[model samples]
Target: MTRTVSDVIAALDAAYPRELAEPWDAVGLVCGDPAEPVERVLVCVDPVTATVDEAVETGAGLIVAHHPLLLRGVHGVGTDTTKGSLVHRMIRSGIALFCAHTNADSADPGVSDALASALGLKVLAPLAPHQVGGTTGIGRIGELAAAEPFGDFVRRVAAALPSTVPGVYGAGDPHRPIRTVAVSGGSGDSYLDAACAAGVDAYVTADLRHHPAGEQLEAGGPALVGVTHWASEWPWCGQAAEVVRAAGNVEVHVSTRCTDPWSLRA
Candidate 1:
């Protein structure tokens, strides 16, 4: 039984439907012939140069990414540009690229859901529940089972995610008790209001802005636990790989390379 790129794409869309993605997001097959036979697939948080190398080295016919390589409109994909170079490399290697950004986030067992499960939280519902579907939305609100100190919860988050250079950081008093929690993998400062409205004890997310975070805390919202964008969303790679594996007899590989732009911290 041979699975083509289109077959794998259909499977991915079923898990994270294209309709669920943000209007501005560029989700779906970026480049590849639908009829191209796919024998192996590589999953990663980012579709950067390093991960592309990993796919080529691993002989992966398809690359499933959480973030799109080219999100905004581009005039050209010449080899001169960074994204263009990636497109060239993948095309030369006969590799297909597909992204599942906001759509995956809006799915029931999406990125945030994976993060919530890793922290051992019993999910209550989506943090910003979509009115249309009711079941699917971005982010999630859940309970920690037993209330733990803010400091302990931070430790648990660090342990659950992939270790990064900056690691995890927390705001608010370490002694604060945390029972109900909200999580939004990747850049989630925008969901502060949603997390606050849910009345969670803490919010675990990535890319917290200085002003927004400070203002939220000043207003006495949920305690903020910040993590690397890569670490926050890394858990979804395994889940996505499993989805692909279940869809077909293709080999699925999760890239171990740390594609996080931040390589060092002082």
Candidate 2:
């Protein structure tokens, strides 16, 4: 039986419930007809031209992105703007777009879970459990498969995530013993307090701005390892693809293309 776009979205919705999403998030289908039969899918962290190009080249019928393409309000999707151009291109190429965003962040086996798996963390619980979803929330608190020096843990993370410019950065003593950790994909500075509260040895996440990080470390918070936002979230693409694949008869491909905005580091 041929599954329509609706089936794919339904599968995604089941795996990453919209109800779990933050109130401000833009989730669900962004474009393409629900009735359109889907033969192939491409899962990615960002919905940029590069990923879209991959979808077009591979003849993928749908692209499931972790980040919302039209996250902010846009009065028009006219071909004049770069974002608009991508929208027009996808439409003309018969490709559909779907965004999971924050909802995927809070799912039981969600974005953070995938990141934890990639980093070999034995997930114990959520860093910030949502009031509604039992044991499902913003980030994951876990322990390493084996305790290693803080420096070794940093090296492990560098090897685990997809390499990109501005490689992983660490805060706190490199000699500090690290066993337990809390991980959240993408920008996770917001969870610094939760990570501290969880009393984990370390916190692994992306996009850790300086001021907050300095303050956290100054105030005797957990060790921090910050990687590229894209690298941090890339693992979820594979997890998401697997969910969709298990749901129906669809050839799902996790895009290896680096959509991380940082091309070079000075």
Candidate 3:
């Protein structure tokens, strides 16, 4: 069976509506013709050169990336430049590129939902609800079935995420009891205040910076578990692949390559 790029995109957009995307986001298709027939698709967190290599090697007809490849404007996509080479490569290979990005983050069973589920949290609600809708927002508020020590919760978080160089690090008393928690999948410092507002026992997220982590802790916010950005969002690749594969006429696969840019932790 075969389906057009448009068919696959319709399934994705229906699952993660473009209307739910932030105003500044560049979600949806990045390249490829809608009318082009597609037999296989690859899903990944980043739309970089390495994932592109995986797509080509695996003979993928389309790539459903969680992040946008062209988030910012570019002068041109000449083969000489880095990003341009990727665009050219995809074009020549008859492959299509599409991104879910913030829309996927804000969807009902979105990025944060996947993150929360991986750590065995029972989802309660969105950490920050969307302005115009219910059950759709930036992050999620959830709770474990039973309270555990913050240290144990931290270990659970680390084990749940894909093993990475940075791994997972926690702040706050190891003995502190953790019941409710909040989560956001990628670069989630922006939601630190929101997580606090939700009054979760802890917050699990990626890319926590020095000052923000300190301020949040100093202000008596939730226990913090900082994970690598790539590891945090990596679970969404499998979730997305499942959604696309169920749409039929498409063989979906999640890229196993870790495109997390951080190489050395020490």
Candidate 4:
């Protein structure tokens, strides 16, 4: 069955409702006409140049991204600027761009859910429960079937996530036993308190800043597992592709190109 851009969007909204997005977040279609026919969709963590090129090369009619290309307000989108160049490229290539953002994070089978499941954790509940349609929330708290040392768990995390230049790192005692785990897929420092309150053995997340992480550890919180932002969020792309595929008869491709800004770490 042929599906238009709006049809695919409706399917996405059903899974990750835009209403669930934080007020500050920008979610939904960034470009393309509602009536435009869509047969191929590309999913990725970021809609950067590499992913855009992937869409063009693969002849994808639409891009469903976890991060919005234009999160904040923009003055212009003329071909000169970085974001503007992306806009022009998509327009010229007849590819639409849509973002899921916080909405996907808050979905029941959301970003954190994917992360937790990837690490073989059985989900218990949302770390910060949202009183919405379903049991959707920002982060997740789960339990490992068997407890393992912090160091072993860190290796497991590194193994689970897509390998990047700066692999996963951990804080707290390497010998500490960890069973219960709390995870947030992207920039999860804000959820440290939630993870601690849940009394999990470890908190796994991405883009953890030095001060917040150090302070959280000083306060005797859970062991911290810090991963690259892209790795933390990449698992959701496959899950999201499933959602899109269920919506219509379109070919969905999850871009494998790593768009993490940090190339090499000293």
Candidate 5:
């Protein structure tokens, strides 16, 4: 059965409300005509150059992403600028782009919850609880059934995430048992203070810059597990795809391409 872009948009908007996005944030349809018939959907953490190519190769009519393609306003749509280039590519190929971003991160079964499950961690509470009409915020704090040493937990995280060389940013003692864990998916430095506030044994996330990691460590913060931004959030694409598929069986493919935007050296 054929589905329109509007169908997918409706399903996503229902799941992750556009209204829930931060005032400065952009969420929902960024490209493509809602009237266009969507036979195939591609999901990814970031709608980067390679992921876009993957979408094209997979014959996707729509690309659902976790990050907004046009977060800040652009002065021009020329191919010279990165955002413009991507916009041009999508328009040229007739591929639609949609971003869930902070809205998805703040949803009930959102980024943190999905990552927690992938690492076999059971959620105790939200690290930063998601507020729905003065409800709460949605970053998760959780625990493994049996407490594992920080080293072992790091290995588990490295295994769970997709990466060439995943870096472990161990903050506390390596021998420390990590029972209560806090996790936020993308660039989560701001939440380090929150994790410390919660007194979590460890906090796992991506794109941990050197200074912040060092500062947090010296400050005796949670043990850190820093992963590639792509690997840290790739699991979210599947979660989103499931949400879309469950709405109705529209051909959904989680793009297998690595869109990390970096090549790590050993």
Candidate 6:
């Protein structure tokens, strides 16, 4: 069976509902001929230079990513800049680009949910529960049936995530048992205050900044563990692929390239 770009977009919209995206997010089709037939789709956390090349090499007709290739309006698509070059390449190759961004973040079985599940944590409620009916929000708070030591949870997260950079910063009592957990997929230091308010024993996500991690720990907030931002959210590709596959018969491939743009060798 054949499917149009709009058909695939419709299926994604039915599940994620583009309207659910935060006002500032750039979600939906960034580039593509919607009427073109889609035989293969690449699902990724970020649509960076390498991921785009991967999609083209794989003969993918569409690229579905978590981060928007064009988050803000682009003044030009000239190859002089990185993003412009990518836009030019996708346009020339006839590969569509679609992003699910904040919409995916806020979805019930969204990025954080997938991350939490990876560590066997059960979502008790949202740490920053999204307001229903298109309202914006933050991360989620969950519970582990049997509390695991913070060190144990860290190992579980590191094992579950794809090949990623080990975090340079860490805080809090590593040996303490962690029961209640908070999860936010992307750069989540901004939400430390909220996580603390929720009273979660540990907060796990990626890209923890120095000030927030230091201050939060010193101030006696949730014990924080950092994962690669890309690794943390990559699980959603499978989850989203499952959603898309359930909606239609199509090939959904998860891109293997990290697209993280970082490698911590030490």
Candidate 5: give its CA RMSD in angstroms.
2.1
lDDT score of model 6? 0.83
What stretches of model 6 exceed 4 Å from their correct place? 132-136, 167-169
- Local distance difference test, per candidate? 0.93, 0.93, 0.91, 0.93, 0.84, 0.83
User: Which regions of candidate 4 deviate over 4 angstroms?
Assistant: 132-134
- lDDT tens per residue, model 3, 93-199: 99999999999999989998999889999999888898645899988899999999999999999889888887889999999999999999998898999998888
* Residues 106-217 of candidate 4: C-alpha lDDT, one tens digit per residue: 9888999999989999999998989634479899999999999999999999999999999889999999999999999999988888899999999999878899889889
TM-score of each: 0.97, 0.97, 0.97, 0.97, 0.92, 0.93
Model 5: CA > 4 A from native = 131-138, 209-212
What lDDT score is found at residue 165 in candidate 1? 91
Pairwise TM-score winner, candidates 1 and 5? 1
What digit string (tens of lDDT, one per residue) describes model 6 on residues 1-266?
78888888888887687767889988999999989999888999888888988999999999989999888787888899999899889999999998998888888768888888887888777667665433235577789889988888777777778876654234678788899999898888778888988888999878788887888888888888887788878888988888777657678898878778786676
Give me the displacement of residue 52 in model 2, in angstroms: 0.5
- Better-scoring candidate (TM-score), 1 or 6: 1
Residue-wise C-alpha lDDT for candidate 1, range 47-153, written one tens digit per residue: 99999999999999999999999999999999999999999999999999999999999998899999999999999889888884487998998998899999999
Candidate achieving higher TM-score, 1 or 3: 1
The lowest-lDDT stretch of 10 consecutive residues in candidate 5 is 129-138
User: Per-residue lDDT tens digits of candidate 2, residues 165-216?
Assistant: 8899888899999999999998998999899988999999988889989998
Give the local distance difference test score of model 1: 0.93
- Lowest lDDT sum, 10 consecutive residues, model 3, at 125-134
Question: Higher-TM-score candidate among 4 and 5?
Answer: 4
Q: Which clashing pairs does model 6 show?
A: 127-140, 127-141
